[model samples]
Target: MPRLVLEARRIALTVQHGLHGRRRAGSGENFWQYRRFIDGEPANRVDWRRSARDDHLYVREREWEAAHTVWIWPDLSPSMDYASRGQAPKRERALIIAFALAELLVKGGERVGMPEMMRPSANRRIAERMAESVVLAPRLPASLPPPFAPSPLSEIVLLGDFWSPASEVAERIELLAASGAQGHLVQIVDPAEETFPFSGRIEFREPESGDRLTVGRAESWRADYDLKLVEHRARIRAAAERLGWSFTVHRTDRPASELLLALHMRMGAGGTASAAPKGGGRAFVSRGPA
Candidate 1:
């Protein structure tokens, strides 16, 4: 059987004009609700057409639409190169998911940005252009808040292994949330990373830098490694809760579409298409209160 050709443009068209038309993400006045016209209400506030149709006085209450500036930041650290379970590395999986999300957000007409690690903008093309592209970073930027050029952030979606110290992300999230913008911290992880399913002695090498360390008993180190992984994930979850942002964990094994749906559920990104995380797999075993 011939395979169907898949493209970003096709995907965007489906999202923009398909079943998600009215609920598509974009900036404009959206219908909220209506109430009876009141004395103090502005003259223009009265929805005359509706009032005439209903044979009664009515006032329109609209929820002004605000453009969603989506920042899909992916951590390009060497640690993200691990790919034990699948053909693509963890980094590749992260990029694919990011692109799929960018497609959906931009298709809905949200201004999508992939700042420095790439670029940030409200243009769907910028995001679509990045779909299936490579992430290019000369070196890790200083572990400080990335300077969002030309302006500040209204929405942020951090996608990566997030191996950096949890404190850094916590601080960033606080700053982002305090800005009154909805933040979604999407942690892209690999199965091998969480489970440390490796056995026997092997030389571990940094995926980006190529630094290597030969461990005598990789299996014996599993307990300690798993403990630290859990701790790290816990800290991120706690920090997200503190900052009032939605936190989601996506495993590379799952389809990127599912991860996008997972995040949409938390942010109410759109309408009914926005549902709970799919697959229901254990991506992260978060501990403590979050």
Candidate 2:
């Protein structure tokens, strides 16, 4: 757990350096920008010192500092424990992303929380606190977060493979979106799951159910498998779009920073997810704000 926390912090720091400034005019203390004072505005709003330098009066604006609450959940189901070719397990990667995202969000003046685990907080040590909570919990969190309506002012982020039945996934999303909170669905997939590189006879096991299927030639199913995968992704994406939420698909082989940067941009843009260029087997789709 300690190691995971440390690694998450490292990744958070790395991404932090690459993030561009997101300053915007608001009621915050920090100066954001200065603009010519309008005639209708009160005289007290003008900055006299700046007006002295120029013929026109100027008004100083401060960056928006309102802290928003964001709930984050990473699936810890049995399936997340699977890894191919000695790659990092999906469970580990999910946890790392969750913790690192918490760190970044807190640093960016947002409150981060885990549904049913941790409450929203802006503590600087948010990542460590979350790790401790996970380790100390009596039992592991469920595959899906408990269904409850969060504050409409809050946003939610769910990270998982999302291999659950399409109906179930759609229903859960509907229940969460009922509260009108913005949401993000991040699908964490293993490279082998996408490629299905096996050719010879192989036995595929269902991680949660312990069901197994033996195939004489696994390569024969590649085309059908790919089609089903694409269809499933489309369904999930459709569900998110219907609710004005965002969906992002990321492969384990890709750098985690890529997803983080995309997510950061979406959140900083007022919870609106925009279409991102596809690259390195990553796909992002952000819908109009609710």
Candidate 3:
């Protein structure tokens, strides 16, 4: 757990340095700017000291200090434990991304929380807090977060392999989007899952069901497998698009920073799709049906 926290902090720091400014005007303690006082406005709102130096009365404005709530869920089901040779487990990568993202959100003055595990908070040590929660949980988290609707002011981020049935996945997404809250779906992929290199006799086991199937020549099914994967992804992507949410795919072999940066930028842009990273991956953003 300690090592995971350290790694998360490192990634968060790296992404923070590369992030651009996202300041906005709103009700906050810090002063943002001053403008000429408008007629019929409350006299007490004017900054007398500033008005004294200038010929015109001015009103001080403060930066937006209202913290937005962001709920994050990292799938820890048995399937997420699967990892290809020389690759990090899907579960580990999911947690790292979730923790790192929480840190970044907290630094931006947002409240971060896990759907059912934790409550929203702006604590600076958010990553550590989330890690501890995960370690002490009674049981492993489900592949899909429990169904719930958050306030419109809040946003959600779900990190998982999302290998669930297409209909089921779409239902969950629709349930969350019903509340009008913005959402992002990040599908973690393994290299082996994308490229089936297995040849000769091979036995494939279902992680969740413990079902096994032995194939005479696994390589014979590569083309069909790839097509199905693409079609499945398209269905999930369409579900998100229908609700104006963002969908991103990140391979476990890729740097976690790439996913973090893309996610952060998307959230900052109000769930709009940002430019994809240099490596091979897809980030889709939709504004609902035209």
Candidate 4:
């Protein structure tokens, strides 16, 4: 099937502040360090509105409604070009996923940034530039770096095959978790990667590396292939769980939009699933995986 391409730049401009392209965070109060409400501090900071009712010395945290930034990285590795089931290549599918998410997040007023593949912010100009990149087609980044740096904490969206032996995929998620930002991993896979559903003395080519191997009936090695595949996926999942990062697996068989809907809901977007229910009266957004 075919997919629709949306302008990337429009989305970036919208979510820069958060909350559907507008400000929704509770207060612009100045956040002072957590202190027991001293008897003589300003009554306004006492959170007295909640005081007489609860009779607890509650200190108010001044939160700046700074913009919410979402970093999206799409894997352009050759492996992503696999698409056994449909017309869209896995690489294009990855881009579609990134664009759709940026659209939704921008609709919610959340800013979006891409590390090396694309620039920061999902605005009209950036989107147009990204579209141009898609058409002209340059080589991908030589390699991925740890996704997060010593920068302000923000959300991250990773689109990739997660095939590197180093498990750099897992390490990146852990870093993001440590920094107290949300992480979403979208793994785009070709059906063949899992099933080894081939036979005959076929020559196999590695997607990332140009290495080739010929496996014939005498050396089918199907069982071994499946075992390694299972182990690789398991390790990725275990790492995600340990890091508390949200993970989603997408095969070319499924619709990209449907996959996106599930991911967005999990990240506390759309109505399918509400961002883990509010605690007491305050809405608590979980920084780690849900």
Question: Evaluated with TM-score, which candidate comes out highest?
Answer: 3
Clashing pairs in 2: 273-286
lDDT of 3 by residue, 6-103 (tens): 99899999999968645667887867789999999999999999999989999999867664689999998888887889998888999999999988
lDDT for residue 228 in candidate 1, whole number 0-100 = 69
TM per prediction: 0.66, 0.80, 0.83, 0.66
lDDT of 4 at 188: 68
Estimate, for each residue in 65-167, the C-alpha lDDT of model 2 and write its tens digit.
7656889988888888878886798878888889998888877667888877888887989998899777776775566667977878778889888887666
Identify the runs in model 1 with alpha carbons over 4 angstroms from their true place: 1-67, 117-124, 131-153, 208-210, 268-290
Alpha carbon lDDT at 123, candidate 3? 88
Residue 22, candidate 4: alpha-carbon lDDT: 37
lDDT of each: 0.57, 0.77, 0.80, 0.56
Ranking by TM-score: 3, 2, 1, 4
Q: What's the count of clashing pairs in each model shown?
A: 2, 1, 0, 16
lDDT of 1 at 125: 54
Residue-level lDDT for 66 in candidate 2:
66
Model with the higher lDDT, candidate 1 or 3 = 3
Better of 1 and 2 by lDDT: 2
lDDT of 2 at 131: 90
Better model by TM-score: candidate 2 vs candidate 4: 2
